[model samples]
Target chain A: MSQTDVRMDGSAETRADREATPGSAGGRRERLVTHRERADSYYGRPVLNEPTWKDHDIAAYLFLGGLAGASSTLAAAAELTGRPGLARASKVGALGALGGSLYCLIHDLGRPERFLNMLRVFKVTSPMSVGTWILTGYGPQAGAAAATDMTGLFPGLGRAATVGAGLAGTALATYTAALISDTAVPVWHEAYREMPFLFAGSAAASAGGLGMLAAPLAEAAPARRAALLGTAVECVAASRMERRLGPVGEPLRRSRLLRLGEALSLAGALAGVTVARRSRVAAMAAGAALLAGSACTRFGIFHAGMESANDPKYTVQPQRRRLAKKRAERELA
Target chain B: MKRNVGKVVEYLPFLGIVAVICTTSWLAGRSSLAGRPSLVRTPVRR
Candidate 1:
C-alpha cells in the first residue's frame, strides 16, 4: 500500500517504478511510452530551412551554365585542332546555353537589375559574387566568338575571344558546386569534396554531346572521346560522393531521377562509341540522351539537397555524431 | 483584324531579333568554315 518499496538488494524503489516494471505486484499500470528511434526536432519541424530556390529555374541554371562553360572550352580546342565545324557548333552552343543560363538566373532573382547589382562588389569568400563576375567576364567573350563565327567577320577578334572564354569557362563549370555546397544542407555540404569533379565531368559530357549532335562525323572523334571520358569521371565521382556521405546521403541514394540519369549517361556513352559514328541520327539521339541525363542529374541533386534540409534528423544526427566523436577523443586524450 | 495587326506590329522588333539570332545560329551550324582556320598547320615545337 506504501508508495515506497524496498528490494532484497537493499535498494529502494517507488510505486511508479513498480507500475512501470512488467509482472510487478503493483499490477503494472498501463502507461504510454513514446520512444524515439532517431533524432527529431520540436513539433517535428525541420532543423534547417529548405532552400528557396525553384527546382526548374536553379537546376536549369546549373545545367546550362555547365554546358556553356564546357562548350566554350571545347570550341577553343576544336579551333586549335583545325576542326572548324566542331568549333563553330561548340561556340554557338556555348553562347546559346549561356544566354539561357543568364535568363534562368535573372528569372529566379525576379529582377534583371538584381543581377547587375551582384556586380557592384567582388567577394572572394562568396561563391555567388565570384560566379557573377565570372559570368560577366565570360559572357561577352562567348558572345563575340559566336557572333564572329556566325557572320564570318573579325576572325582575329573571334580567336582572341575564344581563348579568353575558354580560360574562364573552366572556373564557371565547377563554381556552382561550391555555391550549393557552402550552404548548411546536409547532403550538399557533405559532398563538397566530390561535387566539383562531378559537375565538371557532367559539363564535359554535355558539351561533347552537343558537338557530336551538330558537327560532321569526320570531325566528331574528339567529341566521342570526350563523352566517354566524361561519363567515366562522372560515374566515379558520383559513387564516391554517395559512399562518403553515409546516412546523410539517403536522399541521393533513394532518388529515382539520379539513377535514371546515370543509366541514360552510360547508355549515351555506349551508343556514342558504337553506332553514333556510323549514323548521324544515332549520334543525335545519343547527344539528346546525354543532355537530358545531365539535366536530370542537376535536378536530382537540387531536390535531394532540399529533401535533406527539410528533414530534422539529417541535420541533428550528424551534429550529434560529431559531438560524440569529439567527446570520445577528449576522454582518450 | 486591326487589333491583331497592331499587336504583331508592336512585337515586330522582338520577333526580328529572334529571327536574326535563329538565322545566324543555323548558318553557323551549316558552315564548316564559319570560324577562322587554324594558323598552325602542325604541332608547335617546344
Candidate 2:
C-alpha cells in the first residue's frame, strides 16, 4: 500500500514526493510523521482501507442469506400450521435462496477454492467462521426439506430436517450482523448493538414478501403478519441506530438508496397489511416492493461504510477523541 | 381458483428472486464513487 501525498483538499500533492515538505501545509512544519502520528492526517486521503469485496457478491449475499434463513423458518411454521401451499413455496424458496447465497459467497472469494479452506477452522470469536459452519448445516437441511416436499416422500425425515433447518436458519439470519460489525468499519461496527435485530427484521420482511408472492392470499396470512412484524422491528431498530450513532450516523443518513429502500419497504408492508387480501395484484406488488426495499437497504449500508472508509476524517477523528477521553479518565482515576 | 394461485406461485418467486438480485447489484455498482483524499479538520463533537 503506497501512500500518495494528498493535500488537505483531496488533491494529489505530487506524483513522487515521498517526503512531507514544510511548505506543503501552507508553511506548517515539514516533519515526517507516520500516517497515524500526523494529527493533521485528516488533511489527506483515507487512513483506513476501503472494503475490497465486490458490492454484488458480498452485499447481495447478505440480503440473500437473510431471505433464505427466514424462509426456512417460515417453511417450518407453515408445515406445523397445516398450510401445505405456503410450506411448499417457502421450502423451495429457502433452498433456492440458499443456493444463490452460496454462489455469491464462493464467487466473492479471491480464490474460489478458498471457500473450502474457510471450513478448515472454527473460532468462537469469529463470526465468519461461525457463519461458514451454519451455512454448511443449513444447506443440506434446507435442500432435503425442499426435495422431500417436492417429491412427496419421507414425510417423517422432512419434518425433522425442517426443524433442524429452522434452528440453523436463526443463526444464519442473524450472524451477518456479527460478521460485519466485527470489522473496523465505523457504521457497521458502531451499529453492533442494533444490527442483529435489524437483520432479523429484514429477513422476516423478505420471507413475507416471498410468501405473499408465492402462496394463496388466504393461506399467506401468516406471511403477511410476519411482514408487518419484521418491518416494524426493522424500522424501530434502524431509527435507534441512527439516533445512537449521532455524528457517526451521518453515513446512514447520506445514502439516498437507503432512504428509498426504507420507504419502499414500509410502503410494501402497509400495502400487504391493508390490501393484500383484497387483490392478488396488490399482494404481488407489495411483495416486489418489499424485496426491492430489502435489497436497497443492504446496498445502502454497504455504500455508506465505503464512504466512511474513504474519508480519513471519519477514521482519524473518532479514534483520537476516544483515546483522549481514555487518557483524561485515566488521569482522574 | 387454486390453479390460478398455483400459476402465480410457481413463477413469481423465481422471477422476483432474480429481479431483486439484479436490481441490488446494479444499484450497488452505480453508487460507488471514487475515493477522495483530503485533510478533514473537523472538531470531534462528543
Best by TM-score: 1
Q: DockQ values for all predictions? A: 0.14, 0.02
Candidate 2 lDDT, A218-274, residue by residue in tens: 568888988889889988998899889877778888889888888988998999999
| Per-residue alpha-carbon lDDT of candidate 1 for residues A162-244, written as tens digits (9 for 90 to 100) | 99998899889999999999999999999999999999989988888887777777788888888888888888999999999
Return the number of clashes found in candidate 2: 9
Error of 1 at A252 (Å): 0.5
In order, what fnat does every candidate score? Answer: 0.24, 0.02
DockQ of 1: 0.14
Cα displacement (angstroms), candidate 1, residue A70, comes to 0.3
**Clashing residue pair totals per candidate (backbone < 3 A):** 0, 9
Name model 2 segments beyond 4 Å from true.
Answer: A1-41, B1-17, B20-46
TM-score of chain B of each: 0.55, 0.52
Ten-residue stretch with the least lDDT total in model 2 chain A: A1-10
TM-score of chain A of each: 0.88, 0.88
